[model samples]
Target: MNLHADAVTVLSAWAPSLGSQESLRQAFLGFLATRDDTVQRSCEAGHLTASAVVLDSTGTQVLLTLHPRVGRWLQLGGHCEPSDASVADAALREATEESGMTGLEIGAAPVHLDVHPITCSLGVPTRHFDVRYAVRAPAGALPVRSDESDDLRWFPVDALPAGSEDLAELVNAAVSSH
Candidate 1:
């Protein structure tokens, strides 16, 4: 199936843990129903993005990136590309590239959904409908910082950096279900 079909299938099957998330899912589905180009970054209204809350093999650590543009430590993710087969593929690809880890495993369904406004490379303000997944890295995984991020590091699940409350919520939801 195509990326749009894959996104619909995945989002349709996923059961959000919170009522708020379910509402977002319904909103996303609604957006997709009218905007077939929702997966593209050029979509002026807003676009869907994929992200991953990466956990260590023991599930005690979470890897995060200091987003260059956002200037805050956040989970690994980005806009969908033509090369990405599906939204899940985009999430895994972003996670692996940003973390530089080889044996990462992603969950079958997304763990969280968020909608935030930003002025990205498109140079215009738009909302990012972020679909986040829980990904697990190898026990001995070592990360190499990619140019895409200012920094990439793993922090204890309980003690993320200051002002990372948003990521904390995503991590908590992912850890509980991971």
Candidate 2:
């Protein structure tokens, strides 16, 4: 199935970790039911984005990218692309592209769901309904920073950036799910 259909299937079957997430999941499914283009960036109303919290082989370190545009550390992910076959593929693709790491394995189900507003590449205010997964980097895999990142580094699960609550929560969800 296509990414749009796969998103519906995946989220429909997913179990939310928090009470708040269930409403967001319902919203996502509702959006998908109305628009075929919800998976693409062109849908200005808001779109689905896939991201992953990159956990090290040992699950002690989390890889984060200091997004040049947002000027903060975030999970490895981005807008879903036409080439993406599924949400999981998009998450893994973004993780590999931004982290420059290979042999990454993504969990079969999402670890969390989040929606936030931003002026992304579209250059207009938009909302990103993010589907987040937990990904495992290969043992001894070293990361190289991409042009998309101001910095790409791993932080101990307990030592995430001082003010990043979202990152901390994503890490917590990913670690707990693992």
Candidate 3:
């Protein structure tokens, strides 16, 4: 199937799993229904993005990047590329690239969905319809900083650095479910 069809199928399956959050789930499904080009960067107003909360092997600490553009310590993720086959694949790919680690385990279902405004790499103002998944880093894994981030580090899930309350919520939601 083509990329757009694939995204539609993926989002359709995921939407219902978002129990009790009818509005968020419907919003995603509605986007898929109305926006045939939702997966593409050219969507302009907004586009689908994927992200992950990377947890250490023991699941006590989480890896985060200090995003240069956003200037916040957040989970590892970014815009979906053409090579990404599905939203989950995009999340996994972004986690691997940003964390500099191999063999990280990721699930197919998303842990959270967010719509946030940001400046794209091309300097365009747009919102990201972000689908976040839970990923577990290999034991003793060390993450090297990527060009997208100012720094990368693992912090205690509960004691995350200041200004990371949003990330803390995602991490908690992901961890509590597992």
lDDT of 3 at 11: 64
Tens digits of lDDT, candidate 1, 1-178: 8787888899899888799999999998998898688999999899999999999999999998998888999999999987899998999999998998898999988999999999988999999989999999988999899999999989999999998976777999879976
Per-residue lDDT of model 3, residues 1-178, tens digit only: 7666766676667653446444666777788678778877778878888999999999899999998877889999988889888788889999999988999999777888888887786578988888889998889888988888999999999999999886766888677646
- For model 2, what is the error of residue 19's alpha carbon versus the real structure, in angstroms, after optimal superposition? 0.8
TM-scores for candidates 1 onward, in order: 0.97, 0.97, 0.91
Off by over 4 Å in 1: none
What's the TM for model 1? 0.97
lDDT for each residue of candidate 2 in 22-116, tens digit (9 for 90 to 100): 89899999989998999999999999999999999999999988988888989999999999999999999999999999999999999989899
Candidate achieving the largest lDDT: 2
Name every residue pair that clashes in candidate 2: none
| Clashes (candidate 1) | 0
Checking candidate 1 for backbone clashes, the offending pairs are none
Which is the better candidate, 2 or 3, if ranked by lDDT?
Answer: 2
Weakest ten-residue segment in model 2 by summed lDDT? 161-170
